[model samples]
Target: MEPSSASFIHLRIMQLVGYTQLYYCPKRQNLVRSNILVVYSIILCMVVITWLIYNLVDIEAHWRSLEINSVMETIEYINLIGSGAGYINSIVQSIIHCDKHLKHFKKTMEINKLFKQVLKVYVPWERLRKRLGTVAGGMFLTSFAATAYILMIALYMKWYYYIRYWLLYRILYNFCSLRYFESYMVVSAFKWTFDYLNKCLQELSFLGGKHMDAYEKKNRKFGLYLTEMNYQKQSHKNSVYFRFKILRNIYHLQWELSKVFNDIFGLSLLVNIASDFLSFLTLTYWMLTTMTTFSMALVDVVALFGFLICLVPHLLNLILICRICYLTTQSVMVMFFQASRTALFVHKIPHDPTNESHIMQIEEFSLQLLHQRITFSAFGFFNIDMNLLYTIIGATATYLIISIQFYLSAQRG
Candidate 1:
């Protein structure tokens, strides 16, 4: 963007923040309420005293004086607070404000610092500029035909004209919206936490706060007591508890970061899917709007620009989609290998406490995800390739030649 455009965007972000009302301040609410409550309470106390005096002395003339005093006191307190607010506001203004020249100087300094930071992360600005120029020049060539083709496809996306695309879009939207994997992760995290909290409550209730406090004063975080009397005993050297503590902490931290990344990844997944649909809608709308002008030359330029902006992103996302699939598959395979290795190592321990049950558990966990959480698209475009490849399974080289001949014959017709 140009400098002027960048400045406008910065101004708009500030404007968005400025327009919001100050509705969420608990401190401000308490400050105002405390002042009012103290004044109101005093007035009520004074009136009660006056009523007692009037009843005892048979005098009611002081009632008006009492009313005036209450209102005046309230007003005076409000005036004081308002005056203090004005002075505080003036002080804040002086601290943040400056002459125009100084303001510009400060802005320039900030901009230079930000630019330096950005430059540290990015390639040289001149190199970036040259690369962008080459990309733009290429975009000018293929953009026109791609734009026209995409616009035609979009225009026919309605159910009446193109039921297949509409159905495909619906399926994709629904598939992404399914949160089974994410929900499983959340439930697992909370299950571990809930179990820990339950143990704390169970022990603390019977032991009482005094014992708990004494226990905590000795051992911070979680103190696993063998018994109340044994709580004071020294921790065994190189014990099971000591050895497992390090591993537990590692697993605990991994669980925390796992939940966090799961959330971020899930939300990004949903957002990216919605983005694809919205992009389709937006490009279609742009195409329709530009096509309404229908002068061939103008349409050609509009189509070219439209394709460059719209089609290029979709192409990039296709590449991204393939990489995402490949990486996700590879990571799952690695995790499987880790689990298999862990099981083998643990079971081979000398004089293993876990014998019969350990082997069963190892096998069960290794296959658990395969049975319950393994996701598969049972139906897809690859179904036709199954029969063809199976028929020529012994000679794969013949299958490609057959497919080529088949495609050529279909194309000729």
Candidate 2:
């Protein structure tokens, strides 16, 4: 298989986050790195986990000591829950699923090899590399800026009481950001593969149509016509059979790859989405509470800045994940339709034992596509698609209203 720019970028980023130690060694056609790095990765995860526990306890105590209103108190709790979820997700990715990550990485490489051999599609590695680099760089910069701004604000506000907690939270948040970016690249790769499959199916449809048109245009005597008809029928059948067979294998491989992906990332996705949702809820609630209690002109600039820094990244990350999942699923649907259309075209041709079997293969392929749908989900709880985004927004709004009501009641009392 040719070099993949996305894979290279993903590996580097994953390494930086201590998610994996393996690097592609082209000569060996395998991922190679020291087992010691794996041990180091485990140690890093342990350290992060330890710090997260300490920070959570410290922050909780600090929030309680503030004697804030009910709404503010609730938001603080939600914030801790969200941050905890994210930390747990990082732990799961780096420690528990470490071996699975290695196995899936190798499996995907093998699948890519098969795709190249079967489909013969040209992937623009250089273009992909530049695009992926820009995205990764942008995410890193945004995360860095957010961290730096918060640290600066902590200094300004003299938040010495929980400054350590903020530092630990930022570190954990950056790790989560790295994982999110890596997942995006993986889904993007899947999207690219599905697109190429769709293109292959389109070309197959065109070839079938051309065959049908040529057969109709030919003129021959009755006896000669019968002979030519049989020959043409057999030739088209053979061509369609070979192509469909290759496509079937590719589709099956894709299905297995999806399973591997789910195994590796399913729980992590669940917690990541949960973390983002909770964080978004907490930040939006805090913003709303501040606005209701004080005029915009009188709002604390440092607090407002903190809200923006936290809110924007979580919101953008949520949308990015949903959009990619939706697009990848759409590509799979397009492939399904193409296969169905190709099968219908084949059905119109004269039937023989060979053509009959070809039609069956096509039908089976279509059915497999429908039955074994390719979807990204949060451990089967809910799909990670655009609809999920809408659901999240609606849910957040509902909770925000409830929290505000509680605050109003508490003030009255």
Candidate 3:
């Protein structure tokens, strides 16, 4: 009944599901007031979309008229819009999925209070909140710095023809940056989920020992402790019940979280992966081409390095998400194996603390754990993890090489 880390995660999940806000039931005024914000947001989104489409068309025409070198010069600045497009698409997908996710999560929570409570207990909110705050602050600073640097470089270069283009690009950049903020939310959820599962594994490991300890205490003292033995036995029995309850809840929570991940983030992740892939490829191409002068080459190197620096948070986010999800699966597997060992050991020990019901429930939980599957996939097409990251990098490198070869061939022709 006490608030646990799992409870905190459920609170966050509710916030994302929109049941707390979007469907807040009260006076009619509350519904109207809540919807007013949604209406305002939709209007602003329409404006941004119209503005971006116009600029993208104009820029594409302009770039076609420019020489190859001139086109390449803008590649670094312009392809950012592509990343922006991905981010924008992701935000849109989130909006589309919001209601459905809300309905699904709301129904599940109503039906399963124990799962909600257990899920929240493992979140470690103090540490997670602090880390989330730091991540947000860093992202804000980086965005501000990057914008200032772009403005300065534009003024120094005095490329008036591209000034309008730059402004439009930055506008898109600002809009797409929302994707990162959204990502921060998703990653934070995952961080809490993975951390909770690890805690569950620890609880599972100590479960059998606790039972054995209680049994040993009763035997060692014999009739002298008979009065205390009943109390201790009941207490330990409750403890075993609580631990098994947590294990059962964990399996259910994983399924719920995976559904949340798929509904709310599937398209968004696809957008992010594609956007990052293109950004990295563009940076690589620019860095490799400026070999004619040391100063020019030095500038390219710096640009590439700075670009990569900016990308570190996003890249690290991807890797951490994958690692946490993957590790949680492995941990569950370990827990299942430990349960088998405990069951075998329990049979060997006389006067076991656990009742037949406790053993039956655990065996059921272990079987469920075997069948459980959890993954963060983009649009259900591919799982997002370390393996996906490696594949993206390899694909990007291959394409970058091919594009360079084609460009050389074009120049010769």
Candidate 4:
């Protein structure tokens, strides 16, 4: 089957923005792309890295020249440093792990093919296409608004300041956004697969129910002394064997897909989440300080608007990622429960050697579900879920309290 047009377009956008070095060629069954783009991406990243280093020197010099007046300034400085580090880390990781990335991408494509061709799973490409369009449009509009706001504010600044704030920062921010978009797509793929797996399990239960119902009806028709017909028993046994085997194989493939996903994107996620947390902390602190201490002047109002522009996209990205991860993990747990229930249902049936083997297969699958669980995490440091969101909120509150105390102390002094 052909790939979804929307997915193809989304990936091509990634390629245009230097997020990906190669695109898959379905006809060739391999990743193929011009080396020119690869070279260009490398050069572009190198230029950005050099520009960042130059800006760091300026930041350090500016830091020395200025007095740290408030906790807000400290938070601002930290946020800037964290953002720069995140950009550099993402770029460097992409370059260093280029081969690993390609390998994993190919593996992901193969898994997708297996689902379509061998397992006969239905992927809701239309829904996914709509989602991709909605997310891309939102990111574009948010980035555009932020860029325009920066441009308006930077008009009076020096040439370098205008270029740094308006040009370089926009580029870097878009790069980070693309990385987040990529993660969203990958996670969505996993979530959809888990959904289909659950559906398959449900159908298996229904199949068992139908078989039992047929056996009961036949016994009533043929008199209570009659056993189930030989052909009917063998046919149900065969159907059960095939269905269980397919599900088991699909679950195993899910494990492989998750591993490949982590290998390709784990470090990038870690960096992205850290950058978001720092930005969230800084923005919250700034807004709190502004609201409590400062009067509502035009200048403050404009600054607040700019802060909102920055805050919304970052917060949205964070929440969307965590929410999807949480949903995906929940789906996996649902699959586990479904598998356990199916196993129990099979156990209560009359025992034959074939039935005994099917019970063992299901029990083994249940054990694997318990032990070899799938989780979305940031380089094994923490799982990406609603819990992570809660942790961020709690940590931000604690830090804000500390900063507020210092702010109060400074005022008194």
Candidate 5:
């Protein structure tokens, strides 16, 4: 749409919003790493070392060997049941540790006076931390369960316990590495969403956010004109007035939908609930099928049962990716609504094909730019990696089948 006569401030905000979308990245590694996992592991080791030194000095070597094991055991339980303590700690440390990112974001926001609400990086970080922490917790528990199940399988197969440790830890290491990268993607998604949303809303404001410069003010004035046009006792067929009404409705719908995420950092909870529901289903399947062993049909059950149970999360993960795609597309819809309103408003005016064509061209270009500039924060701030999470499920199922088979066989023999 042609730049409305909104204020220059809002125009600048639009630019910032655009640039923000281009640059927004939560897990650049150079700037931020969830570090929660690394930190927790370190703390666990420290705590274990301290305890062993005091009480197990006589069995120092053996205890030392088991120190990591003990810590992992604790993490497993905490993750399995959910630890409010961990969640609380994430909130508390986010304030201190996130200071640099906050300062940087604030400094950047200061460059543009219009969007103070979004300038505070704390909100985004809070948003990111909450969800990332949940994923981490879920990962910790699932991994432990998978590893234990694997270990049991190896044991039933008569493998050495030491070998089990080695094999399991290798898998654990790969998981940690992949997860760290996945978290990066989530962070990237957050930044992308925030920047794009800020821009789209500011433009549609018809007025502006907290700050509107010359262009935005002009746009606002134009929007005001449209509003007034609607109020006048014009015919329903008055194209200009009708156009604004349609555009206005579309913008309203978009905003309303976005507000569903307005609970500060509540997206994390919503996504987790989704994941857990899927997990519940998958686990329930496994529990039920294991009972099928009571039937004489043993070989076929042995063949496919574990595999399907394991694939549960992978299947759910497909839905999650679709969800992320849908959300991203929905966000783009807000921008489209604005552009659509602009077009309708222009169409209502007497046709100046040249001017209308130019406006349409700009609208298309702007949409493209907006899409390209989308950041990570937007997509994954609260989203989990259902993709990589599939592996954990797969491991768990394989381990379960092998272990349970051995258990049943031993009983019969």
Candidate 6:
């Protein structure tokens, strides 16, 4: 695989985290030794927390009395704890299952070779690379902007409060937030995988429509062509069959991946999504309802920009995965529809026993597609397509309305 290809994203991430050791180190003693890095991360979290507490707790009472300042500090601490704990937890689990999971992933890739087929139709690798890079870059830039704003706040408060504590808080919070960033990489990889699959399905739709035309147009004598067309019909059938086989293999691989990462994904996403939604709603509430000084409002505005940077791209990543899956399944139906139309056209021509095999071939390809529709589901909860997108939107709207109501009631009180 090319260095920038989507298929290698997961491998690169594993290598960065040193999980690749589990794959190559055969001896049990080496395996155990290699896992020390993963284990060390969990221990480091504790050490970091201790260091943060030692510095932070020594801050003056006057700083803690500033409600807005305190609220922001509390949020930062909560973010730090949430992301750090989640990362440590996931790392521990991954380390425990390191050998088995890595082995399984490798064996799956070797045996199925579905990724190779995906690359066939998933042309223009540059587009995939650019799309992923743009989204991820936007996310990191927003995060950095937010961190920069936080630094300004720290610097501003340093004169009045403890400079050392502010610096410690800023550094620790940003470090821990890197965990959520790591989770984004995994989600982005899955999104690209499905997207590539979707593109392949679209290509298949075109091929299905042209299957007969290409076969018929092949150069052969008039009488010889008629005879050869029937035999070539089988080739079209085999081509359709092979495409479906590769698609089925992709679905299975998706399942295996989903299963392996379900807990980590489910929990990480749950926390990230929940936090993001709350941040979005709260940001809205802060903007619409609360009055503040111009400087504080500027802080809010910059923070809002940062939050959107992180929130919008990540949400779009999920939405795109859903949208592509929806489109791919619909494309399969379109393929079937076009094939059926071609079959009907084949029947319209005057009866010629010489053409019987070709006619039957078209009908069979259409029938196969009609009966075996492709559906993509994420961990079997529900299909991860436009339908999931609709559900998420509906839920978000409902919560936003409720939050607005509460905000207005508080204003009245």
TM-scores of the candidates are 0.26, 0.87, 0.75, 0.87, 0.35, 0.61
Clash pairs, candidate 2, are none
Please provide, for model 1 over 47-75, each residue's C-alpha lDDT reduced to its tens digit, 9 standing for 90 to 100: 53454344323212333443534432332
Local distance difference test scores for all models: 0.35, 0.75, 0.59, 0.74, 0.39, 0.52
Instruction: Flag regions of model 6 displaced more than 4 Å.
Output: 1-33, 48-81, 96-104, 111-127, 157-229, 282-289, 292-413
Q: What is the lDDT of residue 180 in candidate 2?
A: 79
- Cα lDDT tens digits, model 4, 142-245, are 88888778677656333244345346556666778778878887888788778988998888877776776677678678875465464576677667767778
Q: Which segments of candidate 5 are over 4 A away from where they belong?
A: 1-123, 161-173, 176-184, 187-203, 206-326, 342-413
**Candidate 3 residue lDDT tens string, 1-413:** 12345445544543442222243334541211245434544555566678777877776677667643664656644465675566457546645665655554453343234435543443444676667667656766766666666565557656555667766655555445545555445545544655555565566556556666767776687977776776766676566567667656756765676677677777766776666666667766665664323365645655555555545544554565566556555655666676666566433333345556666766777677667666668888888767887887788789878988987787679
Off by over 4 Å in 4: 32-39, 58-77, 153-163, 223-228, 348-351
The total number of steric clashes, by the backbone 3 Å criterion, in model 2 comes to 0
User: Which sections of candidate 2 miss by over 4 Å?
Assistant: 1-6, 25-27, 32-34, 56-81, 160-163, 219-233, 296-302
Q: lDDT for model 5, on a 0 to 1 scale?
A: 0.39
lDDT by residue (tens digit), candidate 6, 190-290:
45555555555556555655665666566344655776676667666656546655654564465456556554344434444444445444444444443
State residue 25's C-alpha deviation in candidate 1, in Å. 24
In Å, residue 141's CA in model 3 sits off its true spot by 2.9
Among all windows of 10 consecutive residues in model 3, the one with the lowest summed lDDT is 24-33
lDDT of 5 by residue, 1-413 (tens): 11122223332332221111112233651223335533544464455345434433333344356563543333332322222222232233333334333343333333222232332222243454456456545655654554555455546556453343335333423232232323333333434544544464444344322222443355557875655444331332233333334333333333332332222223323333333334444444445445665465654454345434333433433344434534554556566555555444333333344545535543654555355433222224443334334544576567667756775687689
For every candidate, C-alpha RMSD to the true structure in Å? 28.2, 3.2, 5.6, 3.3, 15.5, 6.8
Decoy 6 TM-score against native? 0.61
